[model samples]
Target: MTTDIAVPKSAQSLEPFVAAGVFEPIDIHAAGSLARLITGLEPEIILGAALAMRAVREGHVCVLVDDAYADIDLSDNAKKLPWPTPEKWRSVLTASPAVRVVEPSETVVVAPGEALVPLVFDGVRIYLDRYYDYELKLADFLLDRSGSERINVDESEIEKTLDEIYGKLTGEIDYQREAVRRALTGRLTVIAGGPGTGKTFTINRLLKASRILDGGRPRAIALAAPTGKAAARMTEALSDGEIKATTLHRLLNITPQHPARFNADNPLPFDLVVVDEASMVQLALMTQLFTALSPNASVVLVGDPSQLASVEAGAVLGDIVTATTPDPDSGSVNVALADCTVTLKRNHRFSAESGIAELSQLVDAGETEAVLSCLRAGHDDVVWIDPSNPDDTARVEQETIAAATQVVNAARNGNAEEALEKSIEHNVVCATRYGKFGVHYWTDKIQNELLNTILDCGADRPWYAGRPIMITHNDYLNNLFNGDTGLVVSQSNSAQGLDELKVIFAQDGELRRFNSSQLGEHTTWWASTIHKTQGSEFDRVVVCLPEPPARVLARELLYTGITRARAHVSVVASEAALRMAIETPALRASGLVGHLRQSE
Candidate 1:
């Protein structure tokens, strides 16, 4: 449908952008279905090894156990707990929740329409959602793939002024220039790069050339992000036109009432679909997008594969990069077909001399010791609290409290300079929710003592009129996203108080109103999770590194967490916790690796 594409290299660096993680190490499965719901714990579910294993392995009902049990620990339980024979395990699959001996019963009050015998029975936690495992779905999609047909574009048919784009964005680097060129030419291209490499800037230039690049075709360009805030950001970036911007889910109208119904042969309304944070797009979602897209419409996948993959299954962005990337080691596993990837090598967010910049480089290379030393070098980033003793958990908690208190005070105070420094100069981050120094603790401390919130959102969080509030979920229609920040101007609630409260978002000096239920999860508390805050940036960031009692995040998390700061960063953690986070290795879905190995 599109023209000659000199297969662009997938990654700039020779080093692998992704590492393979195993789903079902033993390649064995039955019929495949994509789009599974991998939600958090269902209030509290205590399932056992047999049931938990069945739910995850065979039943396609994934569980959300404590991260500490990264492994299900079925074997350990079998040895210690005098459970039934291993051969008889499958019986638990269909056993009723009420069946005491065979079923591992609980006295939980089931919610309407849910079969919740116990949210957590004997300490096994799981969620029950009828979603498909997209990892398996991706495998199915690849298995059905024919071969890649190299797209050839006639230069004679192309316009000559593509270089004019480079002139527009001042100081546009060679890598960016190359990426924009590829995006302009190819029908489907991946602008793969890391933080501050100017993926957004390149996309802006491309959006400007939508007409020139598409050969005078009516520009029905649509922009989408995996999350709401991202989509809102895209909407803002895209200049006024017939262009439509929305979250991928909202674009498909996939709400509770209207489930996604995409026909593979049917073409969509738009001529081009540009997706930001494409790495986060799950397999099932991608499949639907491809199936629903107009046969001739182009797709541009933009994101850094080095960051986290989709929360669901399959690293579609990385898989595509590897398949197209030229690796001597990429034999059958990393097939080269559509060379449609561009990786930005420069760091735009941080300068060379800055500690954060140096930290990012070291973390990317998986250099744990170097990162530790650099952080320990210590700057005036008073937020970087290093613990002297890992054994004393309370001390770390106190340190976190002190630092957060300082940040909250600086940010929420009426002083203009102090507020500027807090909002533009710094952000606070934590590894997980449950720890003493985690996001929950910081949010609570800020709320109970710091902000003096005036109204509750009718959701989980309270609304402070002037405090900077970051939207945690994508409510695209309402112009909210994972990173978009704004202030609460006023609260609107009906007299009965039964209805959802309407919180007006003061965005760019304009009031965009939304109901509290619609606002979803948000944090005025400033501190947030590392995972939630990805794809966003601040001038300065403070990382609250508490020793997680459970699963320690990998080094990439730290890399991403640190990179969020534009000017400075302070990490508060005991040496031991910090080391654990940095040393943890990342594993990609192997099913994707298997699919990518095929030659186009």
Candidate 2:
């Protein structure tokens, strides 16, 4: 199952070609070191530039606007890079959304892309500007010593208390017990764990401990998550009526009218706040959440450290949980303890023998080739469909269709004992929305070609009747949240019905109906972006890797996607494509991530 292919000419060096502080692999992006890798590939130049800029920003680098004349200045007054003489370069650079070349000042606070676009085009040497200001500020805030060591978490006390109150939870595992203990006593607590590790149950046990510590009086514990689906899950997990849950944005009501106004003067409604999936909450949002907390309030952040960081800024959850050595060199203060952090190592979600569980470990090890080899050998739960090539549009399309068809046919035939279960439990996923095996292409294929069971009204969106569907977006009114699976039993069939899909969702033991618009675009077959499925888990998963943009595939995305499945996982891709995604290391700017271990 393990074989090494010929090393690419451009990939001999382990160091990534960082342009304007953004990390990009040479073999895929600009062909290792030589800019000539883009000889005949002119169409991708503009797109490549944009991707480069985005990667840098996502890694927490500031690509601020500067004057074209002072682009290279290291001081406060910036200097711009020299303009390229090539006519093609000038034309494409001007058209990019990142650049504002027509402006008089030339560097008047433009988008981050503007600064990086020109550098990417010309193949100029990009100097690293370490944002020491923000790094120190973040470090100091996390390592605040306001009675941090004073807090005492007695494990025996917590366990005894839990058993006294929650007899059902008396036999909790060691990892869950430790997490609950930390959450009970630590002011700022983090429970870092993977899927099936009983995060919800652990949080519930903490809720029980909170009531016990508060002398049987209900504690005002507010729960919030980054997304609506996660928020809903947070609320549903706790049976206690005292706990109120919502999305972070809704809880803060952060409108333009109310700025970052989370001070002692403007106190929050609850005594404690627990945010789940804290990984997805950006630094900007986290800043507001952190500032809003009263000094007396307890904060609990729960997420997986190995998953992706926020789309906006700082790796808050991981940073807080990481063991940060006061980097005298980087102005990173040494912190002995980070508000009591614990990682649940045991996995109760996917069994140790399950293919998904194995795949997860392989991905964590960055062994893409091993995962591919294991996937190629089909099992009852896991199926691998090979394509002609990663770049062949026709082959990718056919493979996606074939895999989806197999799942559907299995469901209809009831051939496999768990076929119907798999239909509802299985989902198809991809990295991006663009290309042959993307969400739209596969969504259309499943609706019109594969199942072809529902009747379409032919409106703005063809609202089908009695068809299996998934909501792509959140609709609060209909209680139809994204990732909520349901059957489109009926619709208006009138003017009001245009662009709407009538879905009946199973809530609590009853069937509830909602006549909502295409809040979640229909795909008779199910598939979601890796980001969308972060906090969720499934029985089986199909990962479709089309010839996506090089920057889109990485260790974190592939690893996170593989970990979503509980029982089995099937990845549809060519061996070459698999190798590229696996072998290519997505390097993080050394300054962005703290080298702190998760358990620290």
Candidate 3:
């Protein structure tokens, strides 16, 4: 299987240099299915090419075959082949028509598929085939709107109508009016900002202005979010429940028949679609959403770019914002894209002079020292607890329990369910990771110590009365969705020796019973990670940070967790953790912007 190639003796230096740096090798056995897709490649290069392609699909730039034997699994017939050194990888990969080395180094190989444009990189790396297809498809879907006819509306008339609609709102109407104007003039609109920046308010006005422009006839508008909780919030924000919102999945009709019932062949039946909390929308989901839209339909994506990206993969909103953002010096950008983007700046949730607003600005700007200074200065809305110290460690747990004191006391006294529900709605505890200092530790402590309730059904999963659980996946039959919260009300053992539990969802008061064995342990969680708390708001938030800043403590995580609090934020972490959270930005490898620019 070894390729016949000649190498100069002078070039036989193994200094251990990689082309695009080192990347963690993927589990090749788990990716065996992809191996079948690769055809007409040398036996020696087949494993390497498949592993590299799988790595790219998993969000890595390249795959490294560092160790010849350990990095890959060899069959009985293949083990006889020579070890795949860097020189060997280069020569074999170069000879194969299925894969090629982008760099001179022999360590990296990428599959060049039909969807990708000519592979080129100065500082930017090629997205390979799988990621390249996603990026290229999404870019084409978004850019197709440029050729679609825009709404016919007079600028002065629309501006006057926008002013009238926004005048009823609290904040200044200048930004809102401008955003509405751009939205009406463009087929694709993106509204980016942080919390309290009036994105929802602006969207409401945009709908009103669009109706006004259409001679007072309401356009067919559909509202959606990435999660049910976010959709519920969006529904509550606009028109006081007049405009309903649904999850993007439900809107797309994603089912066993296909990933989406609606697609390019069968477009969505709406003239305008507004997606709120767009930050939580992953690249694949966004692509599905866009592909189903009618070419002439107007789309508005509203999200906070400073918040954490979607938990799965891809940064749709962040990439769009970065690509469309204009240069400060020359104000140069794609005119069509610039016209489609709007940044809301005014804060309505927090007062202009509030410390929470100041802290948020600092976090957004990556001013680590300034944030620490504010925390040290004792900001009224920002509470900092150093868990590294013994006293503060206890304080961190105490404060977390104190945040839910009302709910815990109500449960203990057997008080009215209404009051307990009200108390639970106002408080939340968030952790960066699910390890020692994360949600599992805090949830177990709260259930064991505070509630003093436990149920063992011969399974590792624990259940108890008054246990707070968040749904981790959408259950279509039960009408439960990811991000939905619930409380266990009752539990019992059936004659079949099965454990059953009754729970009440926050979305609805109906108590439902289900067997413990019916669902996986991961379907529910007692406490939530910070990423789970995205697009959610609570009056008070207790952020539990591990003593040592882990890789999960990124600037966006801290910002998203803190912004979830409306009244106050209590951060439980060491000083070093805060510094790490403030300094480190979340890194996501995506080529969305590259393809987006190519389309323009």
Best by lDDT: 3
* TM-score against truth, every candidate: 0.67, 0.66, 0.78
Residue 231, candidate 2: C-alpha displacement in angstroms: 1.3
* Candidate 2 deviation (Cα RMSD): 12.2
lDDT order, best first, reads 3, 2, 1
Residue range 224-285, candidate 1, lDDT tens digits: 88876556556655564456567788777666566575555545687667899887787668
lDDT of 3 at 526: 39
Q: Which residue ranges in model 1 land beyond 4 Å of their true spot?
A: 1-154, 157-159, 167-173, 214-218, 237-244, 323-330, 333-338, 378-383, 388-425, 451-464, 467-486, 490-502, 506-510, 514-524
- Global lDDT of model 2: 0.55
Task: Supply the TM-score for candidate 2.
Answer: 0.66
lDDT of 1 at 405: 50
For all candidates in order, the CA lDDT equals: 0.54, 0.55, 0.64
Report the lDDT of model 1 for residue 416: 30
**RMSD list, candidates in order:** 13.9, 12.2, 8.1
Per-residue lDDT over 279-303 for candidate 2, one digit per residue giving the tens place of the 0 to 100 score: 7776557756766776656777888
**The 10-residue segment with the lowest total lDDT in model 2:** 120-129
